[model samples]
Target: MSIQPGEKLVFGAPSTLSDRLTHYCPGCHHGIGTRLVAEVLEEFGCIKETIGVASVGCSVFTYNYIVADWVEAAHGRACATATGVKRARPDRMVFTYQGDGDLAAIGFNESVQAANRGEHITVIFVNNTIYGMTGGQMAPTSLIGQKTTTSPRGRNPKKEGAPLRMAELLAPLDGVAFSARCAMDSVAHVNAAKRAIRKAFDVQRQNLGFGFVELLSGCPTNLHMDPLSANRRVREEMIPYFPLGVFKDVTANEKAGA
Candidate 1:
C-alpha cells in the first residue's frame, strides 16, 4: 500500500510538481497540462528561476501545484503580469498559465499586446472550450454548437460567433517566436503536448521572443460526461473543430536554416 502506482517505475513524478493532490475533476486534462509544464521546467533546470503568473480561474491554483515562484494575477491579466515580471526580472524565466476564458476572452487585448511587443515570456493556455471552474460558461474558444451553462441550447454561431483559434491567431505575430496547439486525449497527443511545452519554455530560455502553446484539454465535469466519454469527445468533436499542431516555431526554422 505504501508504494504508489509508479513509485518503483522508471519514471516518477516531476519534482517541480508538488505532491499535493490536485483540485481537478477526474479525467480533467488540466493535470496533464500542469504536469507537462512542470516536466519542461525540470528539463530546463528553471524550476527555481521560473516565475509563474497564475491567471484567475481553476488554473490559478498552479502556484500550489508547481514548485515555482508565482504571482496571482487579476482575471484575464496573466499575460500583462508576466510581461511586467519578465521586464523587471530579466534574469528569471517568466510564464503564464491561462484558460480559454482568460486568454481568448477578457484578456485577449493584453495577450495580443504582449505578444506584439515580443515580451520574453511563455504562455501555457488551457482551452477546454468552456469556463471549467466558473460554472461552465461558454468561452470565446468554445466551438459552434458547443453547449455550456450560458449556451445550453448549443452555441448559436450566428449570435455567439465561431470559436477562436488562438494558436493560429498568435502565430502570425512578428514578436511571437513560437506558437502551437496541442491536445491531451491520448498518449501520443500528450507526448506532443510535452514537446510543445518544452519548446515554448526554450523560446524564452533562448531569448527568442514571446512563446505560446494552447493545450486543448478536457473538462469532464463541466461537459457532463464521464472520463472516457470526455476523452472521446476530445478525440472526435473537439479535435475536428480545433485541430492540433505547431502553428509556428521560429527557433526551429532558424536551426533548420543553420
Candidate 2:
C-alpha cells in the first residue's frame, strides 16, 4: 500500500505480516528501520528467501514485524546466528537486527569476529546511546557526560571511556564489504538511513561478505524527553560523536576496476 506523509501504516495489509503491530515508542527509529528492511526485502523479491536474526533489546520484536523466516538470538548472539543461517542457506539473504548494547557491548566480539571473517550477512545496528529495553542504562555508544540510569551523574570518560565508533572501527576489516553510520533524527537523515539499509542488503545479495549499518536512533522514553526534544538531542549531542556518512563502500571499489 502507498504511504502518505504523516500517515502511519500498520504492519499488515500489502506489507508483510499481519500480526506484528509496532510496539516501539513514538519517535523511536526501530519502526522506521524495520519498515525499511521489510520494504527492501519486498523490493528485492527476497521475502521468502530472507532469514532474519532478532537480538535482544527493543528490536527483539523484529521477527513479529518482518514476515520472512526468522529466529531469535541471545542477548548478543544475533551475529553468530546470522552467520549460521547464511552458511546453511547460502541462497537466502540473512541479516541481524541489533542495538548498541546488544552489538557493541555484550555482542562486540561476535560482531567484530563475524566482520573479520567476512561472513556473508548484513547487520543493522541501532545505536540510541542508551539501553531502552533495559531501563535506559548507559550503552557502549553512550556519549561522554550522557546521563543514563547507570550513569545518573553523567558518563565519566575516565570511568566509562568514550563512545565506540563502530563503523570506523570496522572500516579497515577485510571481511567488511560495506559499512556506514546514519541517523534518523531528521528527514534527510532518515532518508539516508533508508539508503544505508538498502545498500547493506544490496551488498548481501551480491554475496559481498559482511555489511553493516549503524543507525543513530532516538529513544524518547529512555531519554525522558518529548519526541521533538529527543530528536533535537540526537542532532545536538549524538551526531557530533557518531556523525553521519558512508564510512566504507567496497561496492564502489569493485565497480571502479570493472
Candidate 3:
C-alpha cells in the first residue's frame, strides 16, 4: 500500500467497457458519459444482466465500445426497443443511450410515451445540442444563435422554435419516477452525472417507474471547437439554458414525506 514504483495501479478502465479504442474526437464527452454508465453498471453488479439499446446517430456505434449485450435501434426507436426488451425479459436491466437528434427530433414520440407509461426502464439522453453525425447538422436541442451546418446563420427561434428541454419536459409526467438534467463540463458536474445515472437505474431496480437523465455533453468535432473550448461552451453557454439538477424524483419525495 506504499507509494512505491512496484505497486498496484490506482485506477483502470471499468470492466463494463470494452478495450476497443474509442473513435470519439479529443475532448468529446460521449467517451466520458459512456464510461460513467459502464461504471454504474459494474458497481450495481448488473453488467451481466444489462441490455443496452443503441440509437442511430453518433451513439449508434456505442455497442462497439460498451462491453454488454446491445441491440441497434433505428434512428429514434431506442426507447421503444428498450421497452420491448424490458417487457420480454423482465429480469434484465434495460437502458437506451441516445443523442439529442435521435431522441428529441425523430424519436420524440417514443421517448414521451415511454415515460408517460412509466415503463420500468432507464433512458440516458445525451444532449450535445448538435447532431454529431450526418455532418454536424442543427439539432432540435440546438440553442438559439448556435451555428451549425444546417443553421450556419445560427438557429433562429422565430423560425425553428427554442431549444427543447427533454428533462424538464419529462419530469412532470405522471409515470416518471426520476428525471434530471446534468452536464459533464467539470469534475463536480461529472460526479453529479454519475449520481443521476445510478439513480435512474435504481428506479428501475425498485420497480417504481420510468427513469431518465438528460446529460448536456460536448461535441468538439461537431461544434467546430477544440476539446477545452467545447467543455467551456457546455459550462458557459449550455448550462444557463439547460440547467443541471434533478427535476423530479418520487423516491426523494417519499423519503421527505411529501
Candidate 4:
C-alpha cells in the first residue's frame, strides 16, 4: 500500500489515544465511542489537563484506551467521583464514561444530584440496552420486550416499568447545560454522535453546567446477534424508541446572542 505523491491521509489515530488493541468483544461500540472521545479532547487541545472517571462495567477500562489522568469509581458512583475531581481542580477538564447499568441503574441518583447541582462535568453514557459485562442482565434502560438473563421472558412494562430515557430525563433539569442522544449505527449517525460529544465537552469547558450525552450503542454478544444485526437493532429498534437529537442545549441561546 504505497501512497501517491499527492494522496493525503485523512484519518489516523489521535495522539491522546493509546495505540494498543482494545479488549472489547467484536462488534462492540465501546471502541468507537472512546475513539470519538479521545479525538474530541485532542481537537480541543485539553488532553493533558483532562481527568477521567471510570465506573464499574465494560467502561471501566476506558482509561486503558485513552491517555489521561483517570480515577476508578465504585459501581454507579462515577458522577459522584467526577464531581469531586472537578471541584478540587477546576482547571482540569473532568468527565466520566459509564455504561447503562452503571449509570441508569444504581448510579442514577448520584448522576441526577450532580446534574441538579450544576456540577461542571461531562458524562458519556453508553446505552447498549442490556448489561454487557455482567452476563447480559436486564439494565434500567433495557427496552420493552427485550429478553435478558434477568428477564428471560422479555421485559414487561407493567412489572418492570418503562425504560429510562436519561437524555430526556436530565435535559429538563435546570443545572444541565446540555443533554443529547445519538446512535452508533451508521456513518452519519457516528459523525453526529461525535458532534454531540464535542458539544457536551464544550459546555463543560465553558464552566457553564453539567453536560450529558447518551450514545445508543450495540452489544452483539449480549444481544446474541452478529455485528451487522446488532447495528441494525440500534438503527431500527433503539433509535425509534429513544430518538436521536439534542434534548437541551443552553449554549444555543449563547450562540444565538452572539
Candidate 5:
C-alpha cells in the first residue's frame, strides 16, 4: 500500500524505545515502573529538563528506554549521582531509578544519606524480592523463607534476617519530604503506582526535599513463574510484607507548591 506524506501510520506509534526492547520477563514490574516514570515525565512536560540517574540491577539499563537526559551510575550510586546533578542544575528535575538490591542492599548508605540531607530529588525504587539480573540472589528486601539461588532452602530470619521496609525506614527522616509504597500486580495497583510516581515528580518540580516511591514489582523470570502466577504471588505474598499505601505526603510543607 502506498502511503501519503500527510497520511497517518496505521500502526500505533511506539511509546517507548524501539532500538532497545526491555529485557524484563513477562509480568515483571520493571517495565510497568518505567512506563509510569515516562508517562509522568511526559505529563509534566519535563522530558527535556529532567535528568534520570540509572542504578544497577535489572533496571540498570533504564536509561535506554526512558526518553530523557540520563546518567549511568555505579551500583547503588544513583542517589549520589542524582545529588550532584540536582546540585549543579537546580532548575532541572532530577530523579533516580534503582532496584531493591541496589538501593536497600549495596546502596543503603547512599539512599539513606541522600534522604537525610533532604536532597531535592525523586527516587523510584523497584523491589522484586530477588536480584533479577544477578542470578536470583536473595536481596535485602527478600521475604523471610523465600527461596533464592543463594538461599537454597529458604531465607531464615534468624540467620538471613527479615525483609526491609524501605518507605517506613525513611518515613521518619526529617529530610524526606514524601515516601510511599505501591505495587504493580493489577490495573488498580498500577494506576496507584502511577499516581505515586507523579506525586514524587510533582514534589521534585516544586523543589521539595527528597521524595521516595518504592514499587513492589515482580521478578517473574527469577521467581520461576508464569506472568499470571507472578502477579498472583505479588498479591498473596508481597503485600503482607510490604503493605501498599502512601507512607507520607508532605508536599504542602515544600517551599514551592507541588
Candidate 6:
C-alpha cells in the first residue's frame, strides 16, 4: 500500500529477517535478539555480505528467521565454527547466535579461545539462565538459588557456582575489541541493546578484534512465568548480577597499544 500524503512510515519488519514467524516460545527474548541483529545488518547494508552461525540450542534454527547465508554448528561450537568462517571469508560479516547452555556451558573453551585469539567475528550470546530446550535443565549462567530441572531445589553457590558473566569474562582479553551486555526487558534497554548490537557488528566491519555482546533474555517457559513476569525478572534480577554496559571498547581508548 502506498503511503498517503502526510502519513509517515514508522515500523515494519527488517528486510534482513525472513518473512516466516519465529518458533521461539511465548515470552522468549531470542526473537528480539535475532531481530536486533537483523536490523543492524540491514542498517549496515551488509546482509548480502553477512554469514551467520547458528549453534545447537533454542536458537539452533536461527537460519530460518534470519535471511542470510548460514552454517549450523554443533552444540557449543558456534564460536569455533564462526572463527573458521571469518578466516575463510574476511570480506563477509561473520557472527554467531548462541544461547547460555551452548555458549557458556558446553562451548566455554571455544568462546574464550576465540576471543583471546581476537578473531574478527561478532558473537551474540543470549543468557536466559536456564536451558529452554532439552527439558529446562540448569545452565552455567543460571542464577544463584534459581530453580531448574537439574537444580530442583535451586542452584547452590557452594556446589553449582555463580552464573558465568561472559561479557565481563571476555572483556579483559587482549584480542577482544568490544564487549558489552544489554537487557531486553524494556523499551529503553531494548534500544540500548540495538546500539550494542550495532557496535558489535561495526567492530567486525572495521576488522577489529573479537566482538562480543551478551543479551540478558527471558525464557518464560522454563522459568514457569508469564511473559510479563519473565521480563520483570530480567529487569529486577538478571540485570543486577549481569550489569549492562560496554565492559570493554577499543574505540574508547586513546593511547596506542596501551
Best by lDDT: 4
Q: After superposing candidate 4, which stretches have Cα over 4 Å from the reference?
A: 1-8, 256-258
Per-residue lDDT of candidate 5, residues 95-210 (tens digit): 99999999999999999999999999999999999888988999999999999999999999999888999999998898888899999998899999999998988878777689
lDDT of 2 by residue, 46-158 (tens): 88888999999999998888998988999999999988898888999999999999999999999999999999999999999989998999999988988899998999999
What's model 6's overall lDDT?
0.93
Score each candidate by Cα lDDT: 0.91, 0.89, 0.93, 0.94, 0.88, 0.93
In candidate 6, which residue pairs clash? none
Please, what's the RMSD in Å of model 6?
A: 1.9
Candidate 3 lDDT: 0.93
Q: Residue 119: error of model 4 in Å?
A: 0.5
Give the per-residue lDDT of model 1 (tens digit) for 47-94.
889899999988889899999999999999999999989999999999
Stronger candidate by TM-score (1 vs 2): 1
Count of clashing residue pairs in every prediction: 0, 0, 0, 0, 0, 0
Candidate 5 lDDT: 0.88
TM-score of each: 0.96, 0.93, 0.97, 0.96, 0.91, 0.95
lDDT by residue for model 3 (1-258), tens: 236777787788888888888888898888888999999999999888999999998777789888889988889999999999999998999999999999999999999999999999999999999998888999999999999999999999999999999999999999999999999989999999999999999999999999999999999988889999999999899999998989999999999996
Model 6 spans > 4 angstroms off: 1-8, 255-258
Candidate 4 least-lDDT 10 residues = 1-10
Better of 3 and 4 by lDDT: 4
Number of residue pairs clashing in candidate 6, backbone atoms closer than 3 angstroms, sequence gap of 3 or more or interchain: 0
Candidate 4, residues 133-213, lDDT tens digits: the string is 988999989999999999999999999999999999999899999999998888999999999999999999899999999
Residue 130, model 1, lDDT: 92
Measured with C-alpha atoms, the lDDT of residue 193 in candidate 4 is 93
